[model samples]
Target: MLETPYVAVDVDVLDRNLAGMAAVARERGLGLRPHAKTHKCLEIARRQVEHGATGLTVATVSEAEVFAGGGFDDLFIAYPIWPSPGRAERLRALAGRVALRVGVDSAESAEALSAAVGPLDVLVEIDSGHHRSGVRPADAVRVAEAAERAGHRVRGIFTFPGHGYAPGQQHTAALDEAAALSAADLGDGVRSGGSTPTAPLAEGGALTEIRPGVYVFGDAQQVELGGCGWDDVALTVVATVVSRTGNRVIVDAGSKVLGADRLAWATGFGRLPEHPDARIVALSEHHATIEFPAEPPARGDVLRIAPNHVCATVNLADELVVVRGGAEADRWRVAARGANT
Candidate 1:
């Protein structure tokens, strides 16, 4: 078997994580709209739907289009997208094909979206604690009312508790989400909120849907932050050691493939599979300098690296080899890998 620089997916672990999340959503009576931005593979998306995901959540309209064309009938563009004239036509065309839901943060954008795609299902994004693109909890009603006035239907409220990614913040973030949604008066509608880090702590009360992406492929940051264990890591970059020194070994994969997602608390660029303690200290476009604690990699040895963030790492790959029990079983193409627009 040829092994050098390749993206590999551990099918067993990935299936387990998908099933676990689906079970969580079922138990809570909430919708599981797993973010497609994680893997972006049609095969993985099919598995998610098969495991009982209500629909797919995407970060961009391009991603939504890709999945919709690939036969995913239900999708939610979770970002507060300001659709231009052309993009608006695209959105309307997309809505005609699938059950497309979009996110809106302000009255102006809502009005614009309503004018473009009349009477569409929209979610008023509430800023729980992320301070990203969302209206305040107290302002959610105002935005929803505006969208309603523009002839759009307000489905419910949604938020991204991205602050929950940090340690000791998941509980607070979840509380914020509950309070925000409650205050927003999103009654009998879908109050959606949840990140990978906050998924376990997310209660079933107000949140009717959870959009967790990274849990499918546990990253180094997830492992370091205690969100997931090393065994839960389902994806890895298989790269061959090209250069070797006393303590530093350079690999053939770098930021282009592994991605540059070093959080403040992250120990290094990535984690080596054989020696989890080893740190990928430096990363260039095509080279990664790994500092080994012990058992330095040989010049021709292939090293599997767990990325700091799996979502970004996945966007870099064109395709992924689905491996089960140490053997490659299938290949999945990343249908929306570069669908950034």
Candidate 2:
């Protein structure tokens, strides 16, 4: 009974999600290297390892440092990190401690990383459809060659397949990954690709590993995108209705806690589990405007809000109250919260 407006993790739901993703990986014969950026908690990371995850994927050096310090030996910094000046020594130090894998999408980045940390495992990031930091699939080979010339080991190619978040896009994203890998012409490299929405659609024949982050904690966006359902969301922001107006109710949980990640196709800022028709219309730093299609929530009423994105929401909290069997069991600190840099 710590009070409302706090983050809560449903243990049972979390376990189900973990098992489901693990089963998918096993069935497809793909290694599960779940992204640690979703939770950023050491305890959750350990649980992922227990669930048969081959290793962990992180986004930044700071996150890799946190996980490595917490005894996660195998880690992949999945972001394209430009190793320059002081960062070179830190990269070298990190590589020495754990089996570190870095991503390189360009020849310059590959050369810089290779020069910084000599003879380390590297993955060429192909832009399947996200059009983000990754290089074109046709250019992956050039980047790999550059990394090799710089003395780094090119192990494989990977893509995010982020376009799968849209409707009827998972199959196309997977095909893009295949096409890109084929164009890369890198033989024997681990073909890694996947996001939560696209993981189930992935054939796994070309992919040696699947890195799906949000599967650990389904969110409102997942439900809307058809990646998951309402019961599948494992984490929620438990808030208390503080005020009521005509057709509108205000909750204590706001953008600072719930995050502001409204996708174009999302219903609202977030979704209410108990009242599916109700919508989190607006989110300020301290107030959330909830619109009720049927009825307004009264003051002191407790509410659970499923966020649009779990990873960003988790980053905003300092700790999470883990609930099991409808009872609060434990509190876990958000160990790597704000480890963005």
Candidate 3:
């Protein structure tokens, strides 16, 4: 058996996830730019491309450079980046190598990126109720106009419906995304809409592209949001029980391995795929305390714990063991693990 506190990927389920999202995008007449931040593995990124992803979406210039170096040519930095001199130079080099695009939320960003990268393709970021990095939808046109005047090409608009992560808010977030993109209107450019939560609601009306990261590896948060089934989870931390109490078992995998990203609405720190009722009530540096409904498992017993955020968990691991049909297939490195520039 592999060592405890390591991330494992079931290739069968991973393939299922890849194809399912590809089919959804195709049926909806939308382009699939599956976000690479989730897995950050070159092997998974290759599979996504083979499964019909038009391009890859990354969060930072460094991540884009990593994927570009791996020969995944087409890429978009979905986050609204404030490019420092070093990052700008990197972006320039990456743009020279691949078909690169980035998200812009303000006139200053538009002007600065153009000056830095020399007339790159930029998509204005709309808020769409996320209230994060993006600007108001009604203000997207001004940004687009500023982009064009600044010597950059305004491709269209994109929004991250992050609020969809909450239970029963998927549809509303999707609708808000559509409405925001529609209101942003920069002629007939590619309108990008996000997130795994609202991906299923894409109906070909507003969005031309969908970027969903977590769908490739279902998580506890996805489970709680009704976005994916427990069986659909492709990645999990394989942990070994280290201590046993009356009704609780402490596992070797904890916040350090599984990531400490417990959503406010999340039931627990993590979830047990085998025992649905089990709750990972607490997590220490290298231990996860799970409260099981029944008798706690014996020490040394191995359990798979699905994390609340697959992206963060993936970022923490150095490599993910790939398994197929219940046997070890290969191991993939997290190539973009610290590409957080």
- Strongest candidate by TM-score: 3
Clashes of each: 0, 0, 0
- Superposition error at 109 for model 3 (Å): 1.0
Task: Give all candidate RMSDs, comma-separated.
Answer: 1.2, 1.2, 0.9
Candidate 3 lDDT at 317 equals: 94
Q: Which ten residues in a row have the lowest lDDT in candidate 3?
A: 110-119
Instruction: Write one digit per residue (lDDT tens) for candidate 1, span 1-341.
Output: 75667899999999999998888888888889999999999999999999999999999999999999899999999989897988898899999999989999999999999877777899999988889889988898889999999998899999999988777777898888878877885679888888888777777887889999998989898888888888899999999999999989999998999999888878899886568879888999899999987768689988899999999899998899889998999989999999988
What is the descending lDDT order? 3, 1, 2
Q: Write down the TM-score of every candidate.
A: 0.97, 0.97, 0.99
Instruction: Give the worst 10-residue stretch by lDDT in candidate 2.
Output: 176-185
lDDT of 2 by residue, 1-341 (tens): 47778999999999999999999999988899999999999989999999999999999988998899999999998989988777778789999999999998888988877766677899999888888989987788788888888888888988898888877777888787667666764997788888888887777777788899999999998888877888999999999999999999999999999999988888899998878898888899879999988779789999999998999999999998999988999998998898866
Q: Report the error of model 3 at residue 95, Å.
A: 0.9
CA displacement after TM-score superposition, residue 301 of candidate 3 (Å): 0.3
Best by lDDT: 3
Please list all clashing residue pairs in model 1, or write none if there are none.
Answer: none
Candidate 3 C-alpha error for residue 107, in Å: 0.5
